[model samples]
Target: NIIQNVLSPFKPLPDVVHRITAFAGSGKTHTLRLLASAYPSLKILYLTFNRDDDPLASEKDNKGFPSNVVRQTTCSIARKETQAMGNFEEPRKKVVRDFLERRLGHSLNYKVVDVVLGTANAWMMSSDPELSEEHVRKGEVCELKPEFRALDFVKLAKALYDAMIDPHCHEISMTHSTYLKKFVLSGAEITCKSGGPFDAILLDEAQDVNMVTLQMLLAQPG
Candidate 1:
């Protein structure tokens, strides 16, 4: 009765956005399941936390959601939305290593490589649209050795962030973060690119969502 009453079909409110919040075991997820069951025809985009494997990535199953309901992690959908598909791990790493070496006037190690890339990832997931060392100072980075913290890694990190999204660097593939970052930078919508906009977006754990993820999910015009 609660589900039926709560989910009663209603006209859209232009200035109102509904947010559901409750403690665990308070029927949050149960409500989502009931909503899907009640509205089998609604084209829903079920956005979830990042997972190692995406059930929707394959053709085997739809993760119990109806045919009209699509499910994907935020990053997976971001990558899909941007049409970035491939394993360019080595190319991207080599680019980072070389970029650092050229900047530091010496060979760079993997630790440095990891920090720079990690920093870039942090910057991408941040709320700010602009690339700046401010992201580095935001306490999002991993624990850095004194040598790193003292060596101006912040500026280098921002530079690397800029290089990843640089339009001229076309041959090398963009990382998922790069795709998501550029998606935010260019005001791209987080639509179901293949099928167009979803009729409704069903975010499972809205409270746990980060700003960048929230921005992407809300970007869908529909």
Candidate 2:
């Protein structure tokens, strides 16, 4: 059924979003592969949570994407976009150490720095443009009483958010979550090497995507 629907040759594809939804074990990938073959020249963006679905990786035996197709996870896009702004995790840790030790005059141990950075990252995953107390409360991946630890994780998370957001304070690269969030807010589109937008976007496992990430992908400017 899907094969006939999507693989019909010489069919005029309307310039609009074409969504394909079906239950598990369905021939979704098979159909998509057929669609790509039908129109080999179209640039398509294929998104999925499973690494196996990514055609770029050569290690796996899965059906890889065609040369005209680009596969990316939401996290990969975020990190790629802000790579210049936020170098790497280890370097980010060193920057955090300097900030705590010099600018704030508060010496944070390695473990505490990890916890704070982790918490800040969690907050970035949220839909909020700016970090808030409520977001901190929601961002906690761990379940613990408020007064259980010697280190105040929520407060530290806020401090880290402030520093990251304020470019004038110091130079700390932007986090993936922050950069991804900004990408959505800015309403930008992913373009091709020839400076043209993608012909279409294929989002697999759409049910698992968060509201903010989904919004960001769907709201891209043509």
Candidate 3:
């Protein structure tokens, strides 16, 4: 029975978004770690609740990152090699807003594309206008649909599943819809391109994502 279940090839549902619901300490993070490790090139973005009082607490707490030595893996090494050109706070916020507005703008010369639609993008989009505008101007325009359509729960779910199944596909832009009190996805589309485009994108804490975030991921072309 154990062998059978282990060997069982579970056929995923059409456009199925693999959602693993696990109890606390149920190895959810562990599973992600395994997947990321197996695919060395995979870029994963993890967004956890503000469990820490200090945002930069982790940086201070894990003096040498010995605690996350196991989970960080090659991902951390790559991060070290490609630390942000400067601080990423401003740029990240801009990306988030541009993602939400559904408008693509050019920063340098490359294009800013959306691989997935998620709340993070929405939250960022709605949070600050100036920052969002800067992101669009700095980044290239993503090839989003002509009309800015809001993504519902169902559509968001489909987008998530689509991103996970593709190898060429990378990047997950999620938005947090808590502060502004928005639930569904809504926004307008803008166009622009970047000087240097991104290579990959990853989203962690997929469960906590909202509709807006999921829509950003769906904005990507399969």
Candidate 4:
């Protein structure tokens, strides 16, 4: 299958990294699934970010799963998987090993961290220990959360029109942010935060996002 082909070289290349960003309707999820199916034993990790309603809980239902494998709705897990690959201090690795081997936390082995936003300079960097350079530089990559930050069909259409009519305008450059503000001004609403560092991100229905929304989306790492 396509998934098998995508993951064929992964066993020998576990350290290999990849990032996939596609336009709307580009079958990105399908590709992710194929890769997951190919590397069934590789402990594939999925992620979703924090939201206002649910501030910080890594475990969530996966009504959206494509197969027996559960879909992730937070970057928390992927970050953990990435951290698992790092060569942490012996004591910390031992702790992690004990937690994993002893079936601590019911083998759920979960941890949650806060979400941060802004430009590289906009971030404070000291909020979450997991988000520090020490972790990310150690191969701790996160995948984007599965939730959509904004979803106003009309506003999305307007953004598309604006992009086509004026490619160099404020909306094009300020995409999700400006468009989101406009959408709100027109009596619509959405949610978003600024900065993130995700491993592989796949945004569905991207054409439906505006500048403000794009700004929020791109702010996260993938």
lDDT of 3 by residue, 132-157 (tens): 22323212123443242222323332
Best by TM-score, which number?
1
lDDT, candidate 4, 1-222, per-residue tens: 665665665432422445556776676656656655554443333433321122223324323333424433332232232222222111232333333334323321222111111211111112221123332211112332323222222332233334322424322222122222333233321222222232233343344443434343344423
How does residue 10 of candidate 4 score in lDDT? Answer: 40
TM-score of 2: 0.58
Cα lDDT, all candidates? 0.65, 0.61, 0.33, 0.32
Clashes of each: 0, 2, 50, 26
The prediction achieving the highest lDDT against the true structure is 1
How many Å off is the CA of 74 in candidate 2?
3.4
Q: Ten-residue segment with the worst summed lDDT in candidate 3?
A: 183-192
Candidate 1 lDDT, 107-136, residue by residue in tens? 766776776666666777776776566655
TM-score ranking, best first:
1, 2, 3, 4
TM-score of 3: 0.30
**Residue pairs that clash (backbone atoms under 3 angstroms), model 1:** none
TM-scores for every predicted model = 0.66, 0.58, 0.30, 0.29
Off by over 4 Å in 1: 8-16, 25-27, 52-64, 85-98, 104-119, 138-155, 162-176, 192-195
Model 1: lowest-lDDT 10 consecutive positions: 9-18
Of 3 and 4, which scores higher on lDDT? 3
Residue-level lDDT of model 2, residues 48-152, one tens digit each, is 643232434643524555788777776566545544254434327777877756644666556556766776776666666555555543333344334334555
The local distance difference test score of model 4 is 0.32
lDDT of 3 at 201: 26
